[model samples]
Target chain A: MDLTPLFLPQSVAVIGVSSSNDRHPANVIFSKNLLRYPVRTHAVNPKGGVLHGEKVFPSVSAVPEEVDLAVVAVRAEYVGSVLQECIAAGVKSAIVISGGFSESGRDDLQTGLVDLAARHDFPFVGPNCLGLYSPGIIDTFFLPAERMVQPPKGGVAIVSQSGGILVDLLVKFADEGVGISCAISIGNKAIIRERQLLEFLASDSRTGVIVFYVEGFARDEGRDFVRMARDCGKPVIVMKAGKTNEGGRAVSSHTASLAGDYQVFRSVLKQHGVIEARNEYELASYCEALSCYSDKSIEGRIGIVTGSGGHGAMAVDACISKGLSVPGFSESIRQQLQDGFSASIRSIAAVGNPVDLTGSALENDFVSAVETLSITPEIDCILLLLLPYLPGISSDLGASISQVYRRSGKPLVAYVPHVEKYRMLIEGFELNRVPVASSIESAVNMTSVLRRCRPC
Target chain B: MLKKEIQNILDSSREVGWVLEPNAKSLLHMAGLPVPRYGWAENIEEAASMAAEIGYPIAAKVVSPAVVHKTEVQGVSLGIDSQEKLQEFYRKMSILPEFAGILVEEMVEGEELIVGATIDYQFGPTVLFGIGGTAVEVYKDVALRMAPLAPEDMSSMLQELKGGKLLAGYRGKEPIKFSALTEVLLSFSDLLMDIAPFIESIDLNPLLCSAQGCVVADARIILADQ
Candidate 1:
């Protein structure tokens, strides 16, 4: 199915908009799209009325212009009729935002929606979901615009099973400056599931890295999903829940018992080229890094440059624990890095793999070390542990180091404490397409995840 | 084709939910996996002669649908080096309910490992590799991949196991030829694909590996419920 209209619809109709209650999910979606997004938004209600100064049509058929997408947020009993109206009105696709489907023991009602959609050859997002959010194109989430923080628009695309998780990630991504191409919450997944979304986003022009927050997959769904990911030609990162035995069903053999849901899910992901994130933090770190450096591959050789020796040691430990090598600089590379250092801190600097240009080092010293390591043939990637509080380090340090990153195409990530004072430094690296993490471990995780996505 | 042959075996063994070890071993052998030289014996005389032909220091297991776990039922006796021991094993095993016969096979020992396939709910046929023995349950060191596997998939499965180093040799021991092990794994994968429709799960535990080659020490196949 072509998912273009579902994601990049030019016109949208919001069904079940309420004139009395402004807090209604349908109204929230209607007003958000009408006021903020560029998509022409039309409101629909059984009783014709006015909402936010726009005429609310009695039904989708009464809409003046052609409706490309329908956002249905009516009661479970009324969802089928609304979907039928949408299909009859020639609406290309729909996003069913109402709950009380299979999740609330209304499998029959959910099945009815599926049959109606299939009979009409129509496509829809969910019967129990928060719907999708495509920046500048559409936002079907019920959360009011003011209540949520929309991340800057860029390459990452997130498809999640839980609306709650999707909203939380949007806020986190915004806070971390991780730009997103789109965010989809596929609640219940009665119609569109992760596999279909994966197929769509794998070819999406705006999407460079795809992340999935999956709870579980139905029979044979996971197998198909991984096979698609194996040839998707982009980094597909997944964070699966239910990793323990609590979710396992009764089984007969030692293999069955041992092959718990999470174990098999994890193994197949590795067998394919999909990257598995252990936690929410890893998910965000991986998405942020992969989206920024999608074209770069980490071959497990990491070179670290830190202002503090302690941070370097921690990065080394993190690298080594993840099976990444932090090889010592060769004699010539070591001499070259030392030669580029400023005279004031040249003697005090530790010109090794995790080249520590001590507290007295200037901004130029850090840039020089990064530049030297970035050009070094032995280093696959560079980890910059920037301590902005150093006496000689200036605010332009991020921009200065980004220049070196831009000149040499080697992938670089930085660890900057997420303090307001260092926002510019972080932005400087990020704006230049280099990822910055709040913690040293997160930066190391980014490099490790990149290593997993090595091109075959 | 092996699929038709495997289906015939499943069709004939409809009464036994778990295919007997002798049949499971034959299935593996027919699929080109290495198994110790063996024969089925209906009595003490046959057991003794088969042990002599296959070489002594052999293992004898009860071939009965009533005993799914032979060791747990005390229906297995290893190191039956002489005629007295073979006769003793036959007498002990023949007393068990629904006793079919005795499966006498040459004993082989090396680093014990397990290779199994189970019908996963989501991934369907999934192959499992791990450290095996009686302690398989206790240690629980295992890795899995959806079958039929690619060559790279087989190698990665080995790398994922915590005890995978044992197969590569450890502490001055000669490493088992990875090609030999991978061949067994590949054949097992092909067999799994052929019989997946007829079976729910299969276990080849204690698949002994040495510098020489890998061999299936024990086999079990559980047919899917009708």
Candidate 2:
């Protein structure tokens, strides 16, 4: 059995709800939403029924219809009895959001839970985790999945082994404006391995790009999985968890797995065409890039249009870092970009591969320059760099810049080289399906990821 | 003792495939494994006398260790019916590279087994085993285990093969002694473990299994330190 109910949970019983505690709202929030989606909702408590006017079932077995999912939010000791009732009633999935079991170094409970999960064939998500959401069906997100679910699902699917970390990434990606197809919190992966989910995602049309958060993968099985990703023509970006020396040990505790031959894994990943991300955020950036190329019909030579000389120079530096060579600027495209700028801003130029349009280049200069650069015989994609407050630049900016990028349908990546200026720019591009990174490092890393993803 | 002598020989020689058998016997002598008593001769007269001393039906092999796969060169004569055959084997042994004297010894009788280690391109050194001797290629049953192992692990490894029953003396014969096997295994491990990085590989094929004990009849060790 796929343990269908745990992920696609229909009715949920949330244990441990209290009014006095601040974090206690977690049970109520999920319970309220589970009721709203009209999944059979039960408030399991010894205190009696009637929380938000719904009759509470004293135990999981007491509830009438089949309980698809049960969220055990009590102390770790009480979790066993709660699970016993669920198993007795034949509940298929359980999301154990309580802690102090294995992570606490406790033996009996942890081993018992492992044995229990295997016997029932009921895959449990986490012993300590932020629960997931199926969007429209249920928003059981502890980190507030509703605010994080940005509209219009493009084709980016996620199979994250880390529940807490995955939720953090989901929130960040949602805030950045990239919609998710289905982000799975496949905690521990005691039963369902990454390869099986990868195969499932490959068959799903909703997934254009697959971002895997791997703490560990079975040794030789990884090579076959990478080959399968290539066969499907889906860009699989991996943010491997065990890169650090400390992360290696932590991976064993997080998931019972051995970190094997990282250097050899990297070599094999390259051989099978898996794009490796340096970090979690960069992995997300690569996924977004592939999502655009897979779902949208955006293509052609790139144009690096920028507000400052540093911004343009930084983009060029990033392009090289990502293993991409800047398209040569012919005399005709060069003169047009020059004409789009003021005479003073155009001529003091340390003129080169990245058309440095000087600090005086405003929003309109960006729009005009991109239009002229796109018509060039050389450029196929545009890497647009903009600083939020250029000395003479207007504040009403990104709207006009957005129009030009939107009109061309040419892939334009926008970024503000400083961390503080990144938020608003990220939001602007987030709405447009264009990526806007906050730092030179993130922006360059994003482009490098883009170079690996072929826009189908 | 002979291993050290072989080392001195290897340390001096700049050629390859030349020190094949004698060099192997030297390694076996150093490891304290049982080896055949033989005489090395510079001439056919010397080879005939050595064969006579070894008694009738002695094994006479060409002395050039360079002649790997000696049967390919018509360089070996086993159970020689006469002194004339010993003279013929001695003459052929002289033609091969680094040709020394001939070896005339009483050949051991029993099942032959192959024990070897090959350096894999990815996973370092791997130890291999199978039923051996000249007809070994026919059975084609082999087992492999990673190296740098303990003596205790070897028995578990021995038990893995389907032919373990036969090795343990099936029917009426005595079981292939683990003590004899352990000695060779410990010697093999020390040769690999003690030298550190010097050895790249070691192949001991046709490790003769006699009624008394196991004898390393032929072997090869490739050095990496050079």
Task: After superposing candidate 2 on the true structure, give the runs of residues whose Cα lies further than 4 Å from its correct spot.
Answer: A15-40, A45-52, A74-90, A99-121, A134-158, A181-184, A203-208, A218-224, A231-233, A244-260, A295-302, A339-351, A395-397, A417-428, A454-456, B1-226
Q: On a 0 to 100 scale, what is the lDDT of residue B7 in model 2? A: 63
Q: Each candidate's chain A: what TM-score?
A: 0.98, 0.77
Q: Write the per-residue lDDT of candidate 1 for residues A1-456, one digit (tens) a residue.
A: 678999999999999999899999999999999999999999999999888889989999999888889999999999998898898889999999999999989999999999998898788988789989988889999999999889999899999999999999988898888899999998988778888899999989999999999999988899899999989899999988888878546666778778877888998998888999988899889988998788778788999999999999999999999999999989999999999999998889998878999888888888889888888989889999999898888778888889888888889999999999988988889888899999989999999988888573
Q: What pairs collide in candidate 2?
A: A300-A380, A301-A379, A301-A380, A301-A381, A302-A380, A302-A381, A302-A382, A303-A381, A303-A382, B168-B175
Tens-place lDDT per residue, model 2, A1-456, is 464576566787777665345347346555546555666666676565566667767777877888888877778888777787789887777777777776677767867877887888766766765555555555555553334544345677777778766777776776545667777776545445677677777876666788888776754456457667667677888877765444433210100111124543553455455788767668766666666555343233456776667767767776776656677787766776677776656666433566666776655666777677656657666677777767756544555666666777666666754355545554556566666666656666665666556434
The per-residue C-alpha lDDT of model 1 at residue A39 equals 95
Candidate 2 residue A274 Cα shift, in angstroms, is: 2.4
Model 2, position A332: C-alpha lDDT score: 69
Question: Which candidate leads in DockQ?
Answer: 1
Binned by DockQ into CAPRI classes (incorrect, acceptable, medium, high), candidate 1 is: medium
Query: How many clashing residue pairs are found in candidate 2?
Result: 10
lDDT for predicted candidate 1 compared with the true structure: 0.89
**Candidate maximizing TM-score:** 1
